[model samples]
Target: MRVGGTGHRLLHAETARMVERALHERLARLPADVLVGVSSLADGADQLFAEAILALGGSLEVVLPASRYREALPAECLGAYDRLLASATVVERLAYEDSTSEAHMEAGRMVVDRSDVLVAVWDGHPARGVGGTGDVVAYARKRGVPVEVVWPRGAAR
Candidate 1:
């Protein structure tokens, strides 16, 4: 089973923990032996889901939005990003020269395309920009991929 992840980068401290627990609980229900997680390895929700996948002994696949994707992420996210990237079972980097909104949306599309299901840690709000979590969730729904939303009750961004 291949699963893809999309969610916010900025999260409240308590909300982050809520999201982490929610993601782990949801992911734990999957069949571990054949599980493969696809993600951009961004901070917050992406990293949380990746960590859960690893904890459950599932394989991870990373998709890079652009050649300079790593440099575009927040400095604080670099440590987990580096570790997740290093732990990925497969990594696919796009041909974009820069890590623009377009690159991110394309990366989201790639994740949706490669996944059997899309897991979203969304709060049901519209996307702040062109390539935010909402857009990815919308795209996944449009493509008929099953989506399991992992937003915990009372969680806030």
Candidate 2:
């Protein structure tokens, strides 16, 4: 099964660990042989999910929002992003040259399209910006994609 998710960028350390454990538990419930995870490898939840997938021996498929994704990402996120990209089974970089909001939304769309299940690490809030996690979750729901939200107790952005 293909799984994808959207989450916050500024997750607290305790919250990150909780998210990771939740992802691990979720993946453990699935058949490991055909497991494929799709993600943008963003700073917080995305990165945690990717790591969980890899730990469980699941393949990773990375979807970059734009050509300049590396430059546009926060500096703290760059290392994890690069590491995940290097380990990815497939890396799809959107045609956009710049990392604009449009590009981000398009990338989110692609993630939902490629996923059999969309895992959202949301806090039940409206989207804060054009292409935030909430927006992606809404898009996935609108498209009829099954979404599994993985926000653990005490988890905070």
Candidate 3:
């Protein structure tokens, strides 16, 4: 799985630190040339992992799952997302026709197919209408990709 959700809804500062530490330890065990693909959504687990990957000299491929930055995220998140995109080696826009449309599901499938590993920042459950991290995990699982899920402490719900 080349792309994964950042698990914004179920994370906090301490969890972010823990996740950063865990990912750093894990990435140290991976081959140095591994290319990590991430979504630039800087809410929860995703942002922390992206930062860790970059710090570890790993290349990042950011897949923005929205047509325009402004459409799906708040203005505050756009700046950081753009910074992540700028730092990434490759950036692919998933480009959706509608915010609530399922068309992006195919795009997700393609990203998953291209990725060798899938990491999700899950909160333990799915969000009702947003098609949250669960959607990405499901796609990766369907492809038999390796998955690493990061959950905040006490986040089981």
Candidate 4:
């Protein structure tokens, strides 16, 4: 099973906990041997989904939006980002040199295109920017990719 993810980069502590648990539960349903998580590994939900997949003994396939993608992440998220990147079973780097919105959306499109299902941690809102969770969800829907939204009750960004 191939699952991709996209969501907010900033999440409240409690909301993150809820989202993480929800991601774990959803991904846990898949057989570990066949499970493969595809992600861009952004700070919040993307990292959460990857972690869940790793915890479940699933393989991770990373798709970096640009060559400078690591520099685009927040300082606090750097450590985990590096760790996850190192752990990826397969890593694909895009041709772009800068981590711009266009690169991000293209990366998200790549994930959707490679996925059997997209596990979105969106809060049922419009995207704040061009490549946000909502935009990814919309693209997934347009591409006819099955999307399982995993916004836990009482969760907020």
- State each model's CA lDDT, in order: 0.92, 0.89, 0.62, 0.93
* Strongest candidate by TM-score: 4
TM-score of every prediction relative to native: 0.97, 0.96, 0.76, 0.98
lDDT (Cα, tens digit) per residue for candidate 1, span 3-70: 99999888888999999888888889998999999999888888998998999889999999999988
For candidate 3, report its TM-score.
0.76
Q: How well is each residue in 32-76 modelled by candidate 4, as lDDT tens digits?
A: 999999999999999999999999999999999999999989999
- For all candidates, the clash counts are 0, 0, 3, 0
List all candidate RMSDs to the true structure. 0.8, 1.0, 3.1, 0.7
* Lowest lDDT block of 10, candidate 4: 1-10
* True-vs-predicted CA distance for residue 51, candidate 1, Å: 0.9
Q: Lowest summed-lDDT stretch of 10 residues in model 3?
A: 1-10
The pairs that clash in candidate 1 are none
Candidates ranked by TM-score, best first?
4, 1, 2, 3
- Tens-place lDDT per residue, model 3, 1-157, is 2444345444555776777787677666666566465554545566667776777777787766566544665565567666777898877766564544363455445556766777676665664444556776776887798777776465443
Candidate with top lDDT is 4
Clashing pairs in 3: 1-115, 2-115, 6-46
Q: Candidate 1 — what's its lDDT?
A: 0.92
Between prediction 3 and prediction 4, the one with superior lDDT is 4
